[model samples]
Target chain A: MKRLREVFLSALMLENPLMRLMIGLCSALAISTRVESTLFMGMAATFVLVCSNTIISLSRKVIPDEVRIPVFIVVIASFVTIVDLVMRAYFPPIYARLGVWIPLIVVNCIILGRAEAFASKNDVLASVADGLGMGGGYTIVLLIMGTFRELVGTGKIVMFERTLVSLGSTFQPPTIVVLFPGAFFTFGFLMAILNKLENRWWGK
Target chain B: MMEAARTYLLLFFGAAIVYNILLIRFIGLCPFFGVSKSIETSIGMSVAVLFVMTVATSACWLLWGLVLQPLGVGEFLYIPSFILVIAALVQFEEMFIRKVSPPLYKAMGIYLPLITTNCAVLAVAVESVKPGFLKLNIPYHYSLPEAVVYAIGVACGFAVAIVMFAAIRERIELAPIAKSLRGAPIGFITAGLMSLAFMGFAGLFKL
Candidate 1:
């Protein structure tokens, strides 16, 4: 239990897939314009990660060394296909907004990276914990970025067509915060903040 | 002939600049940051991407039209099939390049394997075949010529963004930046600024 917690915590903070590892930025940045989409994207990615990690961990022994990469990709891609079909059927709006990004998740380096680095070598339980932690960390960062962009860019936060937070009309918002470049700027500053916090606390 | 030439030109510029796969669409960012540390390496990466993206997209395009669509499993199977196509292409390209040109292989060989996971290649492949995927104001269901041209344009856009960013990063290395923000953070910030500049190119050409 403690080992699982350690693995989870390390993935959550010390080795965050987005902020620290920086493996999966493309979809994170693109879908982070709204909290709702980010939440859904996060959930989908976590589902794929956990499932693939578990399957890969169980079958790690049978998979040949020379063919592991392709095997890993096939595993990841199958999961992504599941997410894609489900989203297209149930969440048409998000599926539309996310568009090609949904399919692109197969190539997301985070899933492949973890599969090769952790799941292949670790047990199924640890792999599940790592996947949850990494997915949680990724979702957290996306939420932070999404909230910041939506709040600042529009001066309000709305999810599911409901206004969750509003700054009122007195405040002016910078439209750029919601655009493509804003993603880069927001991610850059947030990562810097995370770096500062890590350095101060860990003394590294 | 003039009309066809003009359409191709518009498609190229539209993909390469107005809707850049890297800066604007935000695909293939892993390599955008990973390879842009040095201009030389970025150039190598750029060449590898250009080669692989064009070839891979063409192959996937053919596969989609020939195999997946005919089998009626394209909607569900495209993700896996496209990925497999890209992974296989990258491997084949590595071996083929090594035998054909040693110097070229040395320049681009290492980056080939990495391209297997670069989302831009897959994104381009899917977008080319699927109509309305990009929202680029162009009609979809691209013919082979159009798809190849669009792939090349997207690759060129990626190359332009990464190579230019690499040049800037080479200079940024000399500047005194905060320790925390010195590396990837600052790179993102720089890309943000560059992306803002790219936005200015919007409406310059409407296809």
Candidate 2:
């Protein structure tokens, strides 16, 4: 029980993929401009991560040590293709928004890095837990970013083309919040805050 | 003849400054922040990206056109096929570099292997096949040569942005900045400002 808890929680907070490791920032920064898109993107990534991790962990022994990297990439790319096709067939709108990003998930270092680092060495159950935990952490960050960007950029929260909440008409929306510069500013500040929180938590 | 020249020129300048892969598209953020600390390392990474990106793009395009299309498996097999080509290309590059130029290989170090997964490299491959988003200023489908030209343009753009960022970061290291904004935070903020500056160059050319 303790091991399972640690395996899961470490991915969320202690060893967060983006905040702490900073491996996967491209998709995080790009698809996070809107909450609805982020939600879909995060779920797609989680599906890929979970499925790929489980498969990789299960086949770790059979994969040749010399060709492991290519093997892992094939597994990941196959899963990404599944996500891409499913999202396109079911949710065309979100699929259009995501576009290249969905396919780019195949190259997301977090998935490949985990497959190489953890899944290759761990049991199937632990790999699944790790995937879920990391995926949860990634999704949480995306939700925060999407909320902040949407609220500040457009002065409202939207989901599936419906307005969830609005900051009222009097609020002046800053256009930067929705642009490339805004992504950098928001990401930098979030990293700073996370750094401070971690410092305080560790008393360092 | 004249039209092709104009398109090539437009793509070169446009991708290099206006729609930079690193700053604008946000395709290769990992190395943009990871290797931009030093101009030397950044230059090395830039060269590595340039080589791998151009080769990977051309190779994937050829695979799609020659192999996948004829075989009628281009739709579902693109993901696995493109990745295999990229991985193989990276390995080939490593071996070719070691044999031809040992010093360059040592300089590149581990970054070459990392190129296989670089989104920018993958972006080049995927975008070459799908034509709408990149807006290469070409009229119809991308030919093999056109793909190579666009790949070189994007790679050069990546090199220019990364090296420029590295030079700025080297100077930022000397400046006395705030405690919290010293490292990656300041780097990102500076990149944001650069991105804003690049935005000014948008719409300068119609093509």
Candidate 3:
């Protein structure tokens, strides 16, 4: 339990991918523009990350060193395909919004990085803990970004049928939030803000 | 033939400047952020990208038109075809570079492999296949050569943007900025500004 707590805390703070390591900024920047899209993307990524890590951890010893990266990519690509197909079949609307991004997930360094770094080397239990911790951290970052970008872009956060978040009705959607520059600027600004907050909370 | 030449030129310039393979399109960012810090390295990497992207676009166009679409595997062919084309393109680029320009190849050494997964190169193929991205109405039954031209043009757009950003970043380094704004902050700012600037090209030459 203590170890699990440590993993969770570290993922949120010390080893945060977006904040500290900056491993998964690609998807983070792309999907954070809308709340619903972020929610869908975050769930899809978490599912892949958790399941892929578990499978990789289980099959670690059987795989040869030379063929590891290829196998890892194959595994990731398969999971991404699964997510892509299922979403297209069942959740067609969200699937439309996240069409190429789901496939793009195969290249998302977070899943592959976790598979190599923590999962392959660790036990199943530890891998699960790592996955949950990291996934939560990623989700939180996405949620915050989604809230900001959506609320700023469209002046409301509409997630599927649920209008769970709203900044203000009067706030006009900043046209920039919907564009590419908005993604870049938001990422840089938010990173700085997070860094500042982290430093203030626990400083040198 | 005149129309073909005109379309090709339009595609090339549009992808490079107005659409910009990197800043506006969100493709080819792996190398953009990775190697843009150094001018010589960025130039070498960009030139390498220009070569592979042009080839990958052309090859994938052929594969898609000649093989994949005909076999009733249009939708599913994307990922598999992409990987195959990218793998082959990387190998070809590696061999060509080593043979033609030894020093440049040596400079780009490992970054060449990084191009295999570069989103920009992948994006060029993806976008060109779609008419709107390339800003061209190539009709439903477009030929392989047409696809090749579209892809090359988009990749060239990527080459143009990266080379431009690479040049800009060189000067940015010389300017005395705060420590936090040194590398990534400036890059982000440049990208943000470029994206903003590129918006002016919207509907300038619509599909």
Evaluate every candidate with DockQ and list the scores. 0.89, 0.74, 0.42
Name the weakest run of 10 consecutive residues (lDDT summed) in model 2 chain B: B131-140
Between prediction 2 and prediction 3, the one with superior TM-score is 2
Q: By DockQ, highest first, what's the ranking? A: 1, 2, 3
Write the residue-wise lDDT of candidate 2 on A51-82 in tens digits: 99999999999999998998999999999999
Candidate number of the best lDDT = 1
Candidate 2: global Cα-lDDT? 0.86
DockQ of 1: 0.89
lDDT of 2 by residue, B1-207 (tens): 999899888877877777888877789898888888788888888888888888888889988989898999887898888988888988988898889978778876777788888899988888888644445444356778877888888989898889899999989999998666668878888888888888788888977
Badly placed stretches (over 4 Å) of model 2 are B131-140
Clashes of each: 0, 0, 4
Worst-scoring 10-residue span by lDDT in model 1 chain B: B103-112
Clashing pairs in 1: none
**Which sequence of candidate numbers ranks them by TM-score, best first?**
1, 2, 3
- Where model 3 places Cα greater than 4 Å from the true spot, the runs are A161-169, B70-77, B95-102, B127-142, B174-182
Q: Ten residues in a row with the worst lDDT in model 1 chain A? A: A93-102
Each candidate structure's TM-score, on Cα atoms with residue i matched to residue i, is 0.97, 0.96, 0.86
True contacts kept of 1: 0.95
- Write candidate 1's Cα lDDT for B1-207 as tens digits: 999999899889999999998899899998888878788878878878888899988999999999999999999898888999999989987887788878767755445687999999999999988775763865468889989999999999998999999999999999999999988899999999999999999969777
Residues A2-60, model 1: lDDT tens digits: 99999999999889999878889999999999999999999999999999999999999
